[model samples]
Target: MVGREETTMFHRDLHPDGRPVKPEEREQLLRKVLPPTSYSDETTRSTSPKPVGRKRRILWSRFVTRIHLILFAIIQAVFSIYLRSRYLYHVIIDRIYTIMYYPHRTPEYIRRDVKALSRLPTHISVILDLHSHDRYDADSSLENLVNDVCEICAWTASAGIPVLTIYERTGILKEYLQDTHRAITQTLRSYYGQHPPSISLRAPHLQSISPPRSPNTLPADATPPRLEVTLISKDDGRATLVDLTKTFAEMAQNRKIGPEHVTGELIEQELSDLTMKEPDLLILFGPNVQLQGYPPWQLRLTEIFNVEDHQGVAYHVFLRALHCYGKAQMRFGR
Candidate 1:
């Protein structure tokens, strides 16, 4: 039962073949089987030393990475500059001239750059309502209105653009014209009779009025009275419309009539008139802040501009407006 004991050897023991265990041999085996404790020291002492240029190669790779980052930044900057130059050349300068020379296009001039587009004309017509002075009432200052008109005429004449005035009603036109004539005479007398630009007030051909409605107008069982629109034929449809908004305001203030009643009446009258008149465009001014029941039918077809400040109506603004009209696309809700 007693067997021979198995032999055991220390790490420094000789091999079973009886060769002495060399330190180099042991270290070589350890180097292959285990991670290095300190590569710098161990590698320096090794018999087969690493190539001397290995450190230099690693440094060269880092330098190459840095150079690549710098080149990428420079390329990005050059691309940005090229794109900006292209936009300025193609969209801003080139397109503006092309738009200007296009055929069948009317030129509108603006004194100030109201729109963001880069190109437009230098002269245009402007029809404006005189808000500084009252449009209605027998006692308001017709002289002030005339002065404003004179300024507008001078501006238009200077810009080589034609201008026109529209009357909301015949009665208002007649009154305005009479007062304008008187104002011209007075100004001439004061300034030694100088001839001023000939200004005229235009009126729609037909005036639509709501018929007086009573219980008898519609039977008790019948629906309430409704407006019967009458069509009138006319040629001078593009006259500048003047709304007597101030008059209506005054009337409402005095309780002579409700604002709704006045607005309704005006809307009825103007809608019918405008359908026949067929104005080219609408210029809203004065106290006529919300179109004020004026020419709804014509308005659908007309381009509108609001100029509440009568004194600020410059020739340039008028020119720009005309230019805008020239450039407008009239597709009718297409």
Candidate 2:
């Protein structure tokens, strides 16, 4: 016999031998086959397209972040330059400051603002509306009224402004003679200590509203003017106040005294004289007080704040008034 042929099959060369193989022979043939796989080692270790796409996304995110930072830096540089220049001063100081107060209650914001104003050299004025009986005290005693005045004076002094507390009731002053006189005198002394001649307390000359004689021919009881008033809306009142101011300017220019306009002793003696002689500034607070019996004559040249009594007297209001006064041009109607 010819020597038996020993042939091994590769996995891909499993073609038919033209006869069924025995189980043992099939097993031997399978064992002779090698495992099938791709030929390139580099292709097997290569990164997938999904991972490459993620890397590109991360790089794009970094680029966007850099652009935002660059824009923020540019904006900061522009703001810094603006602040460095004097252009910001007008915005800081250009405003009319004013405040309103209920007769005796002081708000906390007012105190904070007062502390702020004390640091500055600006002069501020406060107008107070003190109710004599029902408002200021539960006991309706003169001592309470006097105490209220003292408190107000102290507040104004703290803020660096002289207090000009006005009351419609001359009776309140007369009633509180013992208490108010001492209180006011003490306030003046205390205020002058801090501000020297910059501070003073003023009470306008009281117009005598005495009862008429003759019971049979007695006049009807005169109703006191309203302590509260709603100043015409700011727009309307501003125009009217401006017009009145213009008229007063004309009068001042003429310099001739008119009989119809009787200057009250309070207006002539206390406020107008002082303001005109000093020619500094008068900031009227609580313009809604009707100014009915106030220093109406002086208000013409004065920078009237005319805030509502409900506006609550506070430090911020005064600051606003001072700011407005500072920015306002004293044309004297040139």
Candidate 1 whole-model C-alpha lDDT, 0 to 1: 0.45
TM-score: model 2 vs. ground truth: 0.34
List the RMSD of every prediction in angstroms. 20.0, 19.7
**Best candidate, lDDT-wise?**
1
lDDT per residue as tens, model 2, 1-334: 1112324223323334645456676566555453434534445557435777899999999999999999999999998887566444532432323214321323234445544432432333334444533564645644555555565555544444432434332334544344454565465445434222222323323222222233343235521111111111122223433554566568766975454463555334433323321223333444354543443443555555644332344444555665556567779889
Q: What is the C-alpha lDDT of each candidate?
A: 0.45, 0.43
Deviating ranges (above 4 Å) for candidate 1? 1-141, 154-163, 167-173, 181-276, 285-289, 307-312
Model 1 per-residue lDDT tens digits across residues 1-334? 2112212222545655777767776665556545566976677678564576787898899999999999999999999888777656644543463355322111123222334544432322233334445657434544454565545444333233333333332223344444544453344233222323233333345433332334544444533112121211223232323344555678789999895686655754664444433345444433234443344445556676543323343433344455666678779988
Alpha-carbon TM-score of each model against the true structure: 0.32, 0.34
Off by over 4 Å in 2: 1-126, 132-148, 158-171, 184-289, 308-311
Q: Report the Cα lDDT for candidate 2.
A: 0.43
